[model samples]
Target: MDGNTNEQPPAGEETPAGVRRRPWPLRRGAAPTGVRRSLRMAGVTLAVVLVSLAGVVLGVFAGGRVDTDIGPFQATLTLTPDTSGGTTVDIPPLGALLLDSHDGPTHLTVRLGALDQMRTEALIDDPASIQRASVSAVEDVRTGVMRLGLRTVASAVLATLLLAALVFRNVRRTALSGVLALVVSLGSLGAAAGTLRPQAIEEPRYEGLLVNAPAIVGDARRIANDYTRYAEQLQRLVGNVSQLYTTVSGLPVFEPAPDTTRVLHVSDMHLNPTGWSLIRTVVEQFDIDVVIDTGDITDWGSEPEASFVGSIGVLKRPYVYIRGNHDSGRTAAAVARQPNAIVLNNSTTTVAGLTIAGIGDPRFTPDKNTSPAGSGLTKPVAEQVIGAGEQLAATVRNSPRPVNIALVHDPASAGPLSGTCPLVLAGHTHARQVSMLPQQPGLGPTQLMVEGSTGGAGLRGLEGEKPTPLSMSVLYFDKDKLLQAYDDITVGGTGQAQVNLERHVIKDPQAGEPVPVTPTPTR
Candidate 1:
């Protein structure tokens, strides 16, 4: 009876004929504790992997290629995990960013993270320079930057390992582990979003590179269509630029002492903002005490350009202004608003220890709104122009200072005043010329200097013709407050101060000679 009881039930004793309970392969009840724990840990590992994968997908979506536009320039931004595991942006050649004259070297420098950087000392004058310039500085990249990036990755890995160990330990620990994992994921996402695309950029200093390639092409086409002699115009532009760098090398780079007075003669700014920076450089370089602007501050002589008149503030020195035919009364009013600006319209004043007298343009344009006699006035106000010149000459002749200087907009207006002052500075010819007019009775030979359009013939010059040289002159004063030296400097738009380009004509005041000068080789 006992044997019968032990072997009585069949394999499917209480089940249907073909549907038997599948054996779990173990005769023991339930699974062993180790097996159960192993399964649970496997699940935890899988979940961690899934969450990490999701985070990666989210980061990829959040951080995609970004585009930026600054003025007429265009550039692309990209995200990259550097060798040290830190996020960084790789910016494609920004093309030309219209470098701020106050910032940076004349070269392109890639600033990555904090200490990772690379730079090319050469300016991006040609398009090809972009590629050559993108080299990374191995030392800068590997030093401080690597340490920072490694530290970040080490922290993330440490957090992940600790969370994983806790999560695999037991079900009760899952909640704590999950919370920590979520915190890590959130931090990762935030870091990805913040570092992938910088909210703003500190524009790099570059020169002569294409900004918006399409826009640049369109501008070129428009220029060609408007100017009949496009080739000739371009040739002239390049020629003048070459000549400028060539001849300026022959001039001395004087390092005048402090407490000395230097005069900067900037004429026909023509609303070209570039001239302001040029003026500032000359002021600091030469220890200039005064800046004399010979009008034509704007191209159109319109009220809208009045704000540009505030450029006088950039000089940070006493500025003397005389109205040009291209300048209007509104422009004069703007210049007068500056605390450091003195409007010598048919008036005489002392500045930087020198006597300066000047007159305003007489012609307001007969029709007024038609055109400038120079740019806005439709017709030249001839009678008034000539008459004003005569009066300004008569008034400044008796100035008390031995070194009397006259500032006039148009050289034509300055003709009658040649011998009236010790030195007469004028613009409008768009050419640089210095001459000693026939000596007056009591006056030593009076110097009549006509400076090139500091704006390179204003903006109009860029349209009809190849602009004349962008030029300016510096006047040095002796301890006796007498005129010491007058030097001329020319520049190209690129601001590539080349010591060697070609040959050019440099005039010498003392020798009264037009010397052919060759540029020195770059250091």
Candidate 2:
């Protein structure tokens, strides 16, 4: 009784002198049992998710690729994560064709590889072999895809199990991870199957050298209607390939003249991806020295549409640009920011050995909500364009250097520049026209060249029953900066794959005579 009385004080009371106080029985700062259990479960769930993600990434890296033969051609199939589900056929050193073939979290890529020479030759020479090879190619591709799916799933499951074992140190957890991986893989497969678009092969977007993919593949629907027709088409394709190879290999090395300047004239692109491809191909194939765009490079002149102008940099040639009715000041600024681009707005600049002058269109006509107040909202009137042209002519006349070429968006804007420069380029009507303006007493005549829509007038071309053709012109200049000859190039309208070129030669530039306009068809 004496010891208890000496040791004890009220629970909250402090002990005096050397007397010790017993500690409280309850443990402070400890979580409840239910909360601790919940935290443990959360940690396990997080670990499982992280392990599964790592497994999927590793599986894609290790087992996503499979090499197989598509008849005579070898190809590699690969699985890659892409929100935009599609199949891409990549032809090395050329380009790729993208098809909206399916919808899923993963993208399928079939990279065309080396061709078996013997087999290709056999298919080309024998009609029967074409049919057999076509059938075999389809079957082979099917089998290869199945094999790739199995391998990828197995790899992912194995990786998940190993990671789970290392992290959890429990067989039950590892087994659970493997099962999760399988479920995920099956779910992806099911999604792809449900959204498969077999007809997507008919509509493809081509990049780089494969921009001519539509022409090479022909109409898919017609080809699929008859096996014999399909074989015939395949035979022709092989024959064309062989012939092209032979012709190109036998041709002598080409060396363009040092004194000659080649300029590509394109206008009214209107934000067509195919138009950019065509421009790139022409720049490479024709050895173009410069690209001159009269304008309308975009539709809405919105910030989002400015990205298309980035293609100008990729052209790798001097790109002289001007704003069109549909292009706002923002669009012109975006173009000005691109590499190798020169924006002309009542200004003069020399590029690729030619002195040029250009002016922006006076009006901006964009869709509602595309531009700031008082801009890109009104249609361009004729008087406004004429005034812009008069101002540009004054600027050209006061330039420090002689302007060899003058550019404007509308033909009306080109009117005041008749005697200002030897050549005036304009595009607005979406039609091609070439004529010599009447010569002044003491000045040489000006050649007015209006280009058709390089982008087939963009989506608007398809609104009518007959789609407009995509067109451009190649101008050749001599050392004197005189236009000597030019080629008018035309690509078939929508649903057509033919190409036509017409060449015009200026017999005497100094004679103030009209250039002979002859339509020489070459396909």
Candidate 3:
């Protein structure tokens, strides 16, 4: 053996028995002991270097294609490079997912090619199933970063604890171990935070995880940008194609008598002072016991503009509330300050004899609104809203007392509450302001509910043949639990003369109920 002091083995030669293995190359003029320590620190700190050398290997070998299942629908997702700049997806046998089958399973398939591009296909066996399927991918890098940081920290903590046990014996080691563990944990967390992407990547595949790639990149982008548009289109389609029952029956009705408490239901006031004043006046005149304003009290959230401040003193009774599509943090805060208001985003409250559960708005579908300002709740927010609504509804439905009434911002959202509550009051259309419906057979003489200006029509001031009053509605409950509604038109001023309007009661068709339902004490 040669008398060399160097610990490294000669190239292509078998290693000497005493030398320990090291990660760095042992070339001549290589790092000294101090330099090696600095170099090790640098190597770990440079995430790009670590990623290029190691992460790429993990991504290539450990990560495979992603698969997703939407209900009965299943899809195989793969990523391919985009011949174009970024990426686009190919929907194989295009439009197959739109098939209609009530009894069949809706399945989807996707294959990633490279980069982030993928090909998607829909299974058409059950056409109806395809329509019900809501497929999407979750590509949240923050979650992954947090998880990685936590795991690394846990490992560092354990290691520090072991080192303390060995180096400092019992007492000192225990305390020092805790300090070292905390330091290592923080260091690991910092490293993870630094490595995390600033902006979320579209087509995540482990390292670049590929889920439902098309959903992650294409459909999801549209959802994020134009949720209301998508939602509206979906609503139109569902209304046209779906045969699901819109009304649920077998619910006990509240009798329209004076003994029982009745809720004055109104929502989506949309900053309409006329509507607010009308509601308050009617409640006082008819002696309503409870008021439930489902949501959207303000047109633009925040402080009510000058136009809306007049509505502040109108409410006299405690009103249960749920936020609306237009409600913002600022609006919610303002509304919360009202002594008579109870904001129940996903909470329960009781008014009079009714256990009222409330939720805000439904998820914002891009198709829901036709405005350019991105005004309404988008799909994700709408979903959260709807989910909250559903949760509240379920809570109320499951309660000891039956839900007598439900107030929602949009009349369209009342579907879920229809049968659950004996009555559902919704007002988002602004009454269509102006509408024309063509005559159709079996639809009862074309059934027109159009409005004309008060003076222009045949009737007198605030009387017959007037415009549809921008008004509030009161639900009447009697001793027997049968319920009815009364509409109040709004005038102006502080006294009863300024706010009182004519009330129209909606008669029940199934009961063959009589027209001109007389108002009993609304309380």
Give the top-scoring candidate (TM-score). 2
Off by over 4 Å in 3: 1-262, 272-276, 303-314, 362-389, 432-469, 488-523
lDDT of 2: 0.75
Candidate 3, residues 1-523, lDDT tens digits: the string is 4776765454455456755555547669777799889987675445323322232222212222344432322334322211121212323322112111111111112422211111111211122222344332323222333443344444445555554455446655355455544564464334433443424334333212223234322454443333333222322322221111111011123234547566665655654323443454456555678776655565434332222423343466877776666566556666666667677765566666666566666533211231221236577655654565466557666867766555555543443443455444444543412111232333311111212111111011122222223334455555544454443333221112222223344466223132442322110
lDDT string for model 2 (153-193, tens) is: 88878888877888889888788788888887767767887
Stretches of candidate 1 exceeding 4 Å from the true structure: 1-221, 224-259, 365-382, 398-403, 464-466, 493-523
lDDT of 3: 0.41
> Over the stretch 40-76, how does candidate 1's per-residue lDDT look in tens digits?
9898667776544344333323442334322112323
Q: Candidate 2: how large is its RMSD?
A: 13.8
Error of 3 at 401 (Å): 2.6
Candidate 1: the clashing residue pairs are 371-376, 371-377, 371-378, 372-375, 372-376, 372-377, 373-377
In Å, residue 134's CA in model 2 sits off its true spot by: 26
Q: Ten residues in a row with the worst lDDT in model 2?
A: 368-377
Query: Which portions of model 2 show Cα errors greater than 4 Å?
Result: 1-258, 368-380, 494-496, 511-522
Give the C-alpha miss distance for residue 395 in model 3, angstroms: 2.3
- Measured against the true structure, the TM-scores of the candidates, in listed sequence, are 0.48, 0.52, 0.37
